[model samples]
Target: MDEPKIKNMEEFAAVSGISRPTISKYFNDPDSVRKSTRRKIEAALDRFDYRPNMYAMNQNRRLTKNIGVVVPYLADPFFAEIARIIENHVLSAGYRPVLLGSHGDPDLEIDNLENLRLIKPAGVLLAPLGRVSDAERLAAFCADVPTVLFDANIEDLGAAFVGSDNDQSIGLIVEYLCRTGAPPAFFEIRNPVNPNANKRRAAYIKSIEALGHKPHLLQADGEGWEFEQIGFSEGTRIIQEHDLPTDTILCSNDRLAIGLLSAAYQAGLRVGLGDGCALRVAGHDDHPFSRYTCPTLTTVSQDYAAIAQKSAETLFALIDSSKHFDSREETLFNGRLVMRGSA
Candidate 1:
C-alpha cells in the first residue's frame, strides 16, 4: 500500500499532533525538548515516515547549518581528493556540506558565491581560482560570509587562508635534482592560471641561484587547466628540437610532469635516474597518478589531509563565533619530497 506523503512541516506537525516549533526543536536537537515530547516526535517519525524540509526550516533561521565547500577544477584529482576530505569533515562535525565546483571559470566562481549567499550558509571553505579569480567579487563575498580560503589563495580574500608552502616544495625538488643529477631546468606554462605556479617558478630560480647554478626556464605556450596536454605538446617540441639546457627537468606540477613523461616515451627518450636513462624528471603536488607512471614520478607531496582539516576547522570556528577573525589568518602546510624512479 502507498503511504501518505507529508509535503510540508506544517502538515506533518498537524498529523503528528505536535506544534511546529516543537517539531523544529526536535529536529534541531531532540534532547532540547521534554522527554515525553521527544518520545511523541519519535513515534510520529516512525509512524508517518515524515522527513522535515531542512532547507526550508534553515532558511527561516538566521544561520543555517549548511557549509559551502567550493573548489576550482573539481575534475582534477588533486582538488577532488581534497574536496572529499573536507566534505567528510563537515559531515562529521554535524554540519551539512554543500559542494560546488568553479570548473576553472572566474565568472562561475562568483556565481557560486552568490548562490551560497542565498542559502545563508553558516560558513564556507573556498579554494579560489587564484590568478583568474575576480578578486573584487571574491573579496566582497568573503566580507559578507565566514569563509576560509584553501589550496590557492588570493590576498585578503577571506578570514583565513590554508594552502601548501610552494616555496618549500619547489626548493626541495630543485635541491634534490641538483644533488643527484644536472641542475634541473624549469618546465611550466607560459601563462599560469594558478598562483602556485608562479610561486614554484620563483622558488626554483631562487634555489638554483643560491646553489650557484643558473636557472633555465623552458616555458610552454598554453593556457587554462589542460595542463597535461600542454606539458605533452611542449615537451615533445623541446625533445624534438633538443632545446633542453640540462639533462633534468622539474615540472611545475605533477599533471605537467605526467604529460612530459608521455612525451618522452613517444619521443624515444628514456626518463629515469638509472644508467641508460637519458633524462631525469620531477614534479610537484604528488598527483594521484604520479605513482603509476611508467617509472613512477619523483614529486613533492602536499599535506592534503592537514590542509583540508585545518581549513574546515577554521571555518567552523568562525561560524561558531559569528564574528570576523581579529586579523586575517594564513596557514601554509609544508610538502614532503616523494622520491621515485623518474628522478
Candidate 2:
C-alpha cells in the first residue's frame, strides 16, 4: 500500500479535474453540483483523506462551517439544555458550533457578537438579553451575519425567531389552575428580562378578565437570570406578610416557581390538589429541574426540541442560500400541558 498524495481541495481538484470553486461548492452542498460531478468527487474522497482546514477554508472563501450560538446565560439549565439540542443538530448538519454566553451582561453580549464576526461564521443563533441588548448593534450584526433568534427575540433584528407560544402556554396554565381551584395570581418579575414574560403577563390578564375573574398580578422584584432568588425572596415576603387574593399561583417560568415552592415550604404552606393543601402552584417552560422539586411542578412545557431544530435548520438554509430572502420568519411552538403534583 502507498500513502495517498492528495493534501487539500486544490490538490484533489487538480487530480480529479474539477475546479476548486466547484469542489468548495460541493463541500458546501453536495446537491448543488451535477450528479456526474458529485460522483467524481465521491470517488476522490474514497481514494484519499485530504480535507480542508476549517480555519483556512474560511480564510480562503467568504463562508465556512463555523456557526456562532450566543445566549444570554448558559448557566441556566433551560438555556443550557436548548443549546445542547441546537449544538447536536448543527454538528450533524456538518457545521461547527461555537457556544458563547452573554452572562446576562449587555456589554459582554455586544463583545461576543464582535468576536463572532471576526470568525466570519456562516450564521449565528442568538438568544439575546431582551430590552437590555443593544438593538442597534444587534441589527448591524445581523446585517453582516445571518442570525436566528431563539429564547428571547427582538422584532426585525434577526433573520428569524423560534420561541415558545407565550399566549398559549400561559393561558393554558392559568385556565387549568382556575378550573381546579380559585383563579390564580400571575407571579413574575416586575421588569422581565425576556420578551416572553411581557406576552405572558398580557395573556394572563386577558385570560383572567375573559373568564370573569380579576387577576391578582404579583410583581416579584428581581434582576438578571437569577429567577429563583427573586421568586424566593418575593414569594417569602408575599407569603408571610401579605394576604394572597387567590389560592393558586401561576409563575411565568418554572425557575421562579421553584423559588416560590421553597418560600411556601418555609411558610408552612401546603401546595397540591390534595386535602388540606392551601395553594395550587403552576409554572411555564417546564424547566429540566422542575421534576426534581420537592412536590414536583405542574407547568406548561415548551417544545424545546422543535424550537432548537427549526432554528438551526432555518439558519442553515440562510447560510446555504447565501442570500437574504424577504419576509421575516417567526415560529412560535405551542407548549404542552404537563400535569404534575404541584398544581
Candidate 3:
C-alpha cells in the first residue's frame, strides 16, 4: 500500500516518525540537529516531497524573524545600493528583509510601516523622508517596534541613527575646492526634500567663512526628488544669466551637479580644472553616475558599506535585546573627497 501524503509540517512529522519540535528545529537550522537526525529528515523530505511554509511557521512564533528596510526613495542608486547591502546582512543573520520604498510620499511611508507592523517584524531600518515625515506616527511605531534610522535623520527619534557626517564631508570638499581653485558657490534647491541638503548648506557656509571667503548661495526654485531636472533647468538659467559669483561651483549633491554639467555642455561652457576651462564643478555624494560624466565629477564619497553594516548590526542588537536603549544612539561616518577631472 502507498504511504499517506503529508499536507503540513505536523503531518510530515507524523509520517517521518519524528517529534514536531525536532522537525521544527531541523527546519530552522539543519546544522543544529545531529548528523543522523539531519540525514533522516532529508530522507523523509525526499520521500514525501514535503517542504515547510516558513512564513506560516513564523506566524505561530511570538516574534517573526523579519527585518523591515524602508527608504524614502529606492529609485535613487545610493539608497538602492545601501538597501541591497542591508538585505544581505539580514539574510546572513537568518532573518527575512522586507524592503519598501516611500517614493518621496509621506502617506506611502506610513502605509509601509503599517504593513510591516502587521507581519510583526523583529525590527526596522528606515531612511525616512526627513522634514516631511510624520514624526508622531514614527514615534508610535518606534515605541512598539525597534527601528534604526539611516541616511536622513529626524532629531530625537528611532533607537539609533547611522549615516554620513555632512559637516565633515562638506568641510572637506570646501577646503579642497578653495585650495585647488576659486571658492565654490553652493548650488542647491531652495526647498530641499532631504534634511541632509540643509546640513550640507550650513557646513559649506561655515567652511567658507572660516576660510575667509564670502559664501555665495545659489538657491534653485524647485521641489520633489527630480534633482536632475531641477539642476538642469536652474543651471541653464543661472548660466545664461551669468549669475555665478565664482568660477568654481560646488553642488549640494551629485544629481544637481549632473544637471549643471549637462547645462554647461549645452551652453558651450568648458568645465574642468584644465586651462581654458570656463568653470570648475564639484558635488557631494559620489553618485554612481558621477564618474561616468564627461569630465568625471569630483565629489565626496559616502561610506555606503560602513553605514549599511552599522545600521543592520544596530537593529539586530535592538531586536535581540527586545527593548529600546537607555538613550538613543547615532553613528555618523565621515566622507572622503574624490578628485577627478570635473573640479
Can you list the residue pairs that collide in candidate 1? none
Candidate whose TM-score is highest: 1
TM-score of 3: 0.94
Selected candidate, larger TM-score, 2 vs 3: 3
TM-score of each: 0.96, 0.86, 0.94
* Model 3 stretches astray by more than 4 angstroms: 1-7, 43-50
Residues forming the 10-long window of minimal summed lDDT in candidate 2:
48-57
- At residue 40, candidate 3 shows an lDDT of 97
Please give, for residues 243-316, the per-residue lDDT of candidate 1 as tens digits: 99999999999999999999999998899977799999999999999999998999999999999999999999
lDDT tens per residue, model 3, 293-334: 989999999999999999999999998897899899999999
Question: Which prediction has the highest lDDT against the true structure?
Answer: 3
User: How does candidate 3 score on lDDT?
Assistant: 0.93
Stretches of model 1 off by over 4 angstroms after superposition: 34-43
Model 1 gets an lDDT of 0.92
Model 2 whole-model lDDT (C-alpha atoms): 0.89
lDDT of 1 at 305: 99
Clash count, candidate 1: 0
For candidate 2, write residues 1-343 as lDDT tens digits. 9646786788888878889989989987888999999999898777776676666667766777899999889999999999999999999998899999999999999999999877789999999999888999999999999999998879998889999888888778778877888899899999998888999999999988888999888998878989999999999999987658888999988999999999999999999888989988899998999999989999999998999999999999988888875878999998999999998
